[model samples]
Target: MLEQFGAAIQQVNLSTPVLRLFGTTLALLLFVLVSRALLSKLIRTGIQAPELRRKWLVQTRNGLILLFLLGLVLIWGQELRTLALSIVAIAVAFVVATKELILCFIGSLVKGGARSFNIGDRIQVKDFRGDVIDQNLLATTIMEVGPGKLTHQRTGRATVIPNSLFVSEPVINESFTQDYVLHVFTVPFKRDDNWQLAQQVLLDCARAQCEPYLESARKYMRRLGDRRGLEVPVVDPRVSLQVPLAGEIHLVVRFPCRQGQRSAIEQAILLDAFGSHDFSGKRKEGDEEGEEPSAVIE
Candidate 1:
């Protein structure tokens, strides 16, 4: 009876597919573990540059996960094939139900393909402006800068926006190709008091304050223009006079500056302008409290 029982067990083991499935699963598991260890070792010792190492590690990790999933699917594909029609129907229903989610995914793909922006890029979309700190398939994370649509100063806020905005709204790329950006501000003066002299003083102050960035920006922009087959715009200090209000003249100055240093440069320019002989003894036509124009930087 014991011999017969052992014979029955042997027959059952031979006839069942459990052993084959176990063997295949073990093999795949071993492959995944060995490949991951080898790739990690290679990333640690082979890659020297920090940026390159980071990039390699990310790509390799993602690739390994994808490869493991593919192996599993291939191994169990026969079983999955039986349910393909049901899976397709479910997928279609899910996609139809989650239309916004699908649109966001597709928008992310489009953004990636277009390379419209990258990590650390300063972008403004639909009133949200900041540096992109993180990005994923569904949303983008931004460190808030220039809140309330006021100045370009960082507001110490972090925001997450859906990637679908890339498809629906306009994106303003402030730090594209060149690191330097134009800082614009307006200084107000009474139309009667040394306005021309104030303009000269403002221009000279701008040139003196932003001189360091001019040459470097010119070279960088020249290279960018050559690469893109576009003309490089003049990147020097520009002063223009405009009459936004009736009685005051606006001295608008736009100068090349680093994004982070815009406020500092604006302060420096304002301080210098205030101390200038051109801006002293003002208020020829307007009251000191009501007519005195202040410097507004943006």
Candidate 2:
């Protein structure tokens, strides 16, 4: 049986097509090698400059290798095509088995091609929001940014998200502004609460907190708009009123601040607004009974 098996293998190896491919491949490789060696020697002798000689040798070697490859491809084209056809079903099965990995690789390609986001950028995809710490073909690692979007604080945990998500989910890059960002936060108030007073106080606090970087932010935004051909909103502090439900009012304040100082600026504005007016609607000791304190900050 061993003898018969050996004979069978030898027969297959010595088949006409196999011998032809092997002979052609060997001839091409030897030709390329000899041609490269001769050209290298000729270049060294003909070119006095070391740099020019090296350049010529490299180009000659590359050209010869390319020609050798092309020759082999032409010689084995029909055989390769037949082999490919034979494996079509197997190839389909392989693709199905590794669909996710293929998608991840394609997603990486998409990310790179689009220049979607970079390391150190704060990005949000679906429910994941974080600063991209590392990235690879398979997944991206991020330092988790928040328990909620409003907090704008790191959660001290790392999340590895499959790169495949890049294909399906929209990525929001918060750090696109680099240093300064237009941060928006909401202060909710009851309809019966003095919402007008709350809105005014919040606006004042935002303007005061954002005053230092307001002009710089504006200029940066204007330049960004001109460069990107975008219609960017003004960086000035502004407040808008929203009514999400009956008897519920939301005061949305948009303010410009350093990217890293969003939470701090927000806290400062909240504290200042809180101190300026009594949000609890509780009367002070000096106030008579039935005197409402102010609009409550929910």
- Maximum-lDDT candidate: 2
Candidate 2 CA-lDDT value: 0.82
Total clashes for model 1: 0
Q: Per-residue lDDT of 1-298 in model 2, one digit per residue for the tens?
A: 9999999998987797788888988988898888888888888889997545654665576568669879989989988898997899999999999999999988988887998987677999999999887776779888898888877899999999999999998899998877678888988888767666677778778888887878889898988888899998777888887889997889888888887899999999999998768755533455434343334322
Score each candidate by Cα lDDT: 0.78, 0.82
Report the lDDT tens digits of candidate 1 across residue range 1-298.
9999999999998866756766787898898889888998999899897646655665576567668778888877886888888799898888899988888878888887888887677899998999777776678888898756546678899999998888888788887764787777887877666566677677888999988768998887788889999888788887888888787888898988886788898888888987756554554554444443234322
RMSD of each: 6.1, 11.8
In angstroms, the error of model 1 at 281 is: 8.0
Off by over 4 Å in 2: 1-87, 282-298
Instruction: Judge candidate 1 at residue 278 and give its lDDT.
Output: 51
As a whole number from 0 to 100, the lDDT of residue 61 in candidate 2 is 63
